[model samples]
Target chain A: MNYFSSDFKLGILGGGQLGKMLLAETRKFDIQTYVLDPSDEAPCKIACNHFVQGSLMDFETVYNFGKQVDVLTFEIELVNLEALEKLENEGKKVYPSPKTLKLIQNKGIQKEFYIQNNIPTAPFEKFESLENLKSKIQNLKLPFIWKCTEFGYDGTGVKVVRAISDLENLPNVECIAEEMIAFKNELAVIVVRNVSGEVKTYPVVEMEFHPEANQVEYVICPARIDDKIAQKAQEIALQVSKKFNHVGLLAVEMFQTQNDEILVNEVAPRPHNSGHHTIEASYTSQFENHLRATLNLPLGNCDSKVAGIMVNLVGEENFSGPVVYENIEKIMAINGVTPHIYGKKETRPFRKMGHVTIVNEDMKIARKIAEEVKNSIRVISTK
Target chain B: MNYFSSDFKLGILGGGQLGKMLLAETRKFDIQTYVLDPSDEAPCKIACNHFVQGSLMDFETVYNFGKQVDVLTFEIELVNLEALEKLENEGKKVYPSPKTLKLIQNKGIQKEFYIQNNIPTAPFEKFESLENLKSKIQNLKLPFIWKCTEFGYDGTGVKVVRAISDLENLPNVECIAEEMIAFKNELAVIVVRNVSGEVKTYPVVEMEFHPEANQVEYVICPARIDDKIAQKAQEIALQVSKKFNHVGLLAVEMFQTQNDEILVNEVAPRPHNSGHHTIEASYTSQFENHLRATLNLPLGNCDSKVAGIMVNLVGEENFSGPVVYENIEKIMAINGVTPHIYGKKETRPFRKMGHVTIVNEDMKIARKIAEEVKNSIRVISTK
Candidate 1:
């Protein structure tokens, strides 16, 4: 199809930062886009051709939006599966089909599929409810990780349980009791595929964690590891994508265990923050590649030209009003530092406000600059 | 100015392809923009916050639009300068200041500025008009290049007058006759500056010409020349920009003489076609930097992570109606090829419909892929 500068409309389900960045490429190709978001203050509220405020999980809202566009895609996975399935039955095109989302939406089912497909992952047991876990405590391992079967993300509802009291606080809902593997490093691999079955995987990246927060603080490309190990990680990621027959971008989070073994952690179906550095450092940005893949166009080069690091701008703990980026001007003086404020006017504690991308020919220098950027900028409340 | 997601407005004087691309950045930052253009079907018609249809050169139309925004900038040079000057006197900030535009709006005066600043350039003589040129032919050298003193671009109103007959078809207008110097290559250097007096230059880029049309068909990054020569070109461009006190992007087109000397050809004070490859190749795109510089924000990194080449997609000569990019899919199959189809649905011979940018670690490979893209896609009329 002639998608460029045409009357064709692409419907996007989410209107946050990922959708906002994707809109940049759509604007470049002059592709018409329609955005349906829950909030009127979405980052994509102004850039798209049409904007509708509606819940993505509402069957009528999503189905109606899908019917108007030539193609449909989403930047987030928390949407109504029934609506997407109905839209597909009605002959509307939805990338990364509803079936694929269902299989991976719950942590328990996703882990089972990996085991069935011979994909390496930390061993875990599924529970219908936290009450079931209590009844089976005598047979379970201590210091295990408990995660809700569904709707768990961004450090929410995932916790380490070393004692019986840990189970008392979690909701009595379907959950997964996962083995706490002694992994040396956290890694990620982003794979792009189309309906034609063509697939490509980006180089393995390592996530440096903050010792206290249990959150990713820095993502380093060309993971400073053995070349053979990196290859193993990429090979496994390709197998996962092939097994799932995924479309668009599938970012596989993995763990490199102490024995230099790769294990699947989780996956996000759209552009992941782990790949944000590509906007400044890669030959083709993940956001651009996501658009190309969803449209069934050929994939682009995903190699990095230099080393890159991303620093997320999460709101400070004490601030919860109108947002201001303090010391943002200081980082601009440093070479290769780029701050991308997501155009979010308000901020709450722990909410993502923006990100800073630092790239340099020398990987070491890039990482140093990234640390400085992280230290200088604060997304704090002004009121 | 709290431009991000605020009520502050920026008024643009033209809604062509350049303005369309600029509007993309403004919306990305959620800075409201108002565009003024004569054509309601302009490429920027759908993207700007407000698009007003009117003559860009009309004094009243231009002045009235300029008054609506906090600041004013333009993508096209052929606007009512008198109206802009009046707006500036009324305390409206105009980038590439009206004074700088005055020196550049006329080619004869621009050349004089170069000579006065001791900038190296090809020898040229200005004439009062084409009627007077014939009388002074005895004093001028043979086989000279003739160009209109004002409003000449894209090889328009320019010709090599090798003999008297070659000048017969020329209209009576003030023109400049320039000596055709032997040059090894054509090059360009983009220098970005802000009101804060900070300046930075992109690497010198070499433009390869199409032998038959004598037009730039591909622009190669890093110039493929000696490092010293490339640095010299950038330094010369910086000197020129400093002399003009030019704000925003100043693309200095240069000629690399056979003896490895860099000579200034002219300057364009906006996001220029010569810098388009930077969108994919540079760490920070030229459009984003243009917005930043205009806002007096800190500059961005201008280094290229990979070599890039851009091929123009001009309308086919035989087709002139609703536009279609025949075989666009074929071009997508070529690695590193990304097309930017400007939202121009109409087609006309020699009109720039869009461009394709190819980036790769190897310049040689990128150039080859660019050739495949140029050969595969045809900007034609569906009608």
Candidate 2:
């Protein structure tokens, strides 16, 4: 198909920062794009050829948006799957097909699929509701992890249960309790697959969490791990991609147990925060690779020219109004620093406002600068 | 100035490919931008905050547009100088000040300024008209270069006068005759200066022209020359930047004479095609630095992460209709090859539809793939 500067159009669901970055690639290729977003102030509002302000979960909204484009893909995974299934039945192209999304959308189902495929993972038990798990508390372990089966994003639906009282304030919804294994490090690998079955994997990245907040503070590429462990992480990620037969990017989050064994944690079937550093470090950015995979175009090389590190810029606590990126200029003065603001007009505590990427030939230097960047810039509100 | 996600607006005069690329950086930082261009179908129509379709050379149109922006800059040099001067007089920030632009808007004045600054350049004589030059044809040297004083772009309004008949078809306008000098290579260096006087220079890039068309076919960075020659070119470029006292980017095109001396050819006061490869090769892209310099923000590192080469994609001689990039998929299959297709719907002979950038750690590999890219893709018409 003649996609560049042609009548062909690619439809994207969810117009947040991911869609905004994807638009940069589309603009680079001169490919036409149409975006559907729930917010009028979405960062992608201005960059796309057409933008529809509507709910992604609305059946008619998603179906209509899909019908107008030649090929359809999404940045967020919470779209109306029924509409996608209907469109696919009517001959429209929807990448990461509805069938694949079905198996990955619910946490209980995803974990079960891993176990069925002989994938190594922490042992888990599914409960119909939180109350059902509470009734069997006498039979369960003292410390475990509880996660909601559906509609959870970021850290919203997961928690550690050290005591029975922890379940009292939890919502009475479908849940899963898994044995919490002591791990040496948290790692992630992004695997990309094209419609033609060509696949590639990015290097493993280690996630460093803030001590108090327990949120991801830095994502370091090359993982600073043994070569064998990195290979194991990538191999498992590729196996997961093949079993799901998914098209586009699949970001597999994993854990390195105390004994150095790899365990599958979870997977996000889209561009994840783990790969954001690719924009400045890798040969082809994850956003561009996703676009290429969805379009069935030839995938680009995924090697890094230099070591890279990414730091998330979340809104600080105790402020919630029009946002201000304090000390942004100071950080800009630092070498090899690039900030990507999400164009969000307001900021609430812990809300994602933007991210900064630092890249250098020396991994140690890149990490040092990343810490300086993390300390210098604060996402706050004007209040 | 809170430019990121704030009320601040940046006004750009031309909405061509340069402005389109600049918009990518502005979008990265979430800086609001307004673009003015003569064509409604301009490449930048989709990416900017507000796109105004109007003449860049119209005094009232430019003046009114400048009134709505906090700081104004231009991608093309053919803007109305009076509007910029008026805006500056009224306290609006116009980068690459109108005074600097006045010295550069005309070829005759620009050459004179170079000589007055004691910069090394080829000997040249200015004339009021072509008829006047013809009257002194007996005294002038044969086989000199004839260039119109005003309004020349690309290869237009410039010619080689090898014989008297060569001047018959020339336009009757003010012109200059330059002594032709033997040069080993054509090179360029991009110098960036901020409003606060901070300056940085990109590495020198060598231009390889097409044997038959006399147009630049490839731009190789870190020009395959001795380190001392590269340093000389950079130093000369810096001197030109200082003499111009320009803010934002100044692309200085120069020549390496057979004696190993550098001579100033001319200067462009905005993002130039010579530095397009910086998008993927340099630590900070030229577009990002241009925006930072104009905003008086600190400049980024000017070092390169990898070697880069750029090849221009021009229309084939026989095509003139809806454009089609034939064999584009074949070229995309090559590693580190990226094509930037300008959104020009129609294809005409020699029209610059786009460019392809090839980057790698090995300059030899990059140059080899650049040739494969140049041979594989053809920008032809659909007829």
lDDT per residue (tens digit) for residues B1-383 in model 1? 55655567888889998898888678655678999999978988777878899998899999999999988888988889999999999999999788999988899999999999999989999999998998999998889889889877676778888898999989899999998878998999999998788898988898876553445688888789889999899899999999999889999999999999889988989988888898888887788888888888788889888899999888878899888999888887777788888889888887889989998889999988888888889989888
| Model 1: residue B84 alpha-carbon error in angstroms | 2.6
Model 1: docking quality category: medium
Best by lDDT: 2
Candidate 1 regions off by >4 Å? A131-140, A162-169, A209-215, B1-8, B27-32, B134-139, B209-215, B259-261
What would the TM-scores of all predictions be? Answer: 0.94, 0.99
- The interface root mean square deviation of candidate 1 comes to 1.9
Task: After the best TM-score superposition of candidate 1, give how far the Cα of residue B81 lies from its true spot, in angstroms.
Answer: 1.9
Cα lDDT for residue B51, model 1?
A: 88
List native contact recovery per candidate, as a fraction of 1: 0.60, 0.84
Candidate 2 residues lying further than 4 Å off, grouped into runs, are A211-214, B211-214
Candidate 1, residues A1-383, lDDT tens digits: the string is 87888888999999999999998889888889999999988888767889999998898999888999988999988888888899898888899898889888888989999999999999999999999989999878999989998887676768889898988879999999999989988999999997777788888898986554456788888788899989999998898888888899999999999999999988888999889888887877898889989999888778888888888888888898877778876787788887777878888877877778899999899888888899898888768
Q: Taking the candidates in order, what DockQ does each have?
A: 0.57, 0.89
